[model samples]
Target: MIDFITGRGLLLLSLRRMYELWVNHSSQIIKQFSILIGLPLEMSNNSDSSLEVFSPAKFPKAMNELSALLEAIAATSIYFKAEIVVSYIKSHSLRIEWIEANPALAKIVTSGLLKTFSLETLFEANRNNKNFLRDVENHISKQLLAG
Candidate 1:
């Protein structure tokens, strides 16, 4: 059982690392393009355009594709983390067992959910049309799972 848990933990860590790299790389590329276009990117106030940023000229297909990819990754990470929490809750035969075995673990896991929602709010509030919410959603999803 210990080996199983350890292996899964390692796998989660690896996935998280990969997710971080992808998010960072995507941000860097976006920042580079934003600079090249001489645009000072700002958050969108509208929900429809929140995750995207736009300028007068059109962006390349690859850039749009990358943006979409970031969104997908964010969604996936969110789901993964949610599943882990649900799994943990279900695995505990008794509520007291969970509380007794890992008193702080539950609180920490619960906080992950709170943090996820917080990021979601940030994403929605910014509304920059840069797909920032999608990026954040992806990051939180992965983090929830790994944590």
Candidate 2:
């Protein structure tokens, strides 16, 4: 029984290690793949300057890291999406505050995403669903990807 327990612990450790390696490799691949696809795609909209994609011109490393991090986020499960989004919001609340100061821009971003996802029509259907966080993340992911 002790030997069995030890084997099971080792297996769990190995699985965790594999997962870590996979995430690291995947992040690296995304970094490279995005570059190959001619990254830093320019996005513009008249309505919202705050929602504008982060400028690679100012923070190239941040741009790369955010891109890879967002890709990993996209691949995450719905249950964790809300947790991640909430954590992100908590961490970046200052940015959100600044963006919200320009209400028009926030409106444009929310409206544009709602239109793109057609959530404007069906928001009531899934507004309370746990997966809504996942939807929000996907929207943010798109905006980041546009950079």
Candidate 3:
């Protein structure tokens, strides 16, 4: 049982590490591109056209494509992690008892980490549900305060 829990914890840690790498790399790339493309254009002209070019409205398709690419990358990592966990369970002949004992891990594994951490979900929430970030911030603030 300890081995089973340890293996799952390690899998979660690996997933987190992979996710951090993806976020860091994607953020750096986005920052570089925004600096190169968005900054110069904004500086040159404070016009609607300049803003429009960089706006989400102007390049919805491109934004979607980029989002899909990022999702694919994240999903791949999650799938890899899931595979590792499954392989460990199989090799050790671990039973379902560990999952039953750890409800949090069970939920994550069953529903999938990718779905829970989805960027598309974030974007959708931001777009369709205004104040999503504010809600998230408030929730975090409450949690921190409680802690």
Show how many residue pairs clash in every candidate, following the order shown: 18, 0, 0
Misplaced by over 4 Å in model 3 are 1-6, 30-50, 54-147
- How well does each candidate superpose onto the true structure, as a TM-score? 0.24, 0.23, 0.21
Q: 1-147 in candidate 3: lDDT tens per residue?
A: 112345777878777877887787986775665453322213225433322222343334433543443343343323233323332222322246654554443444444432323223333324433344344334323422332
Error of 3 at 22 (Å): 1.7
Candidate 1 C-alpha lDDT tens digits along 9-36: 7878777877887787987886776555
**Worst 10-residue lDDT window, candidate 1:** 112-121
Candidate 2 segments exceeding 4 Å error: 1-6, 23-26, 41-50, 53-147
lDDT of 2: 0.42
Candidate 2 residues 68-124, lDDT tens each?
544544543333333333333323222455344544433333342321222221222
**Ranking of predictions according to TM-score:** 1, 2, 3
Model 1: lDDT equals 0.44
lDDT of 3: 0.39
**Residue 118 of candidate 1: its Cα lDDT?**
23
Worst 10-residue stretch by lDDT in candidate 2?
114-123
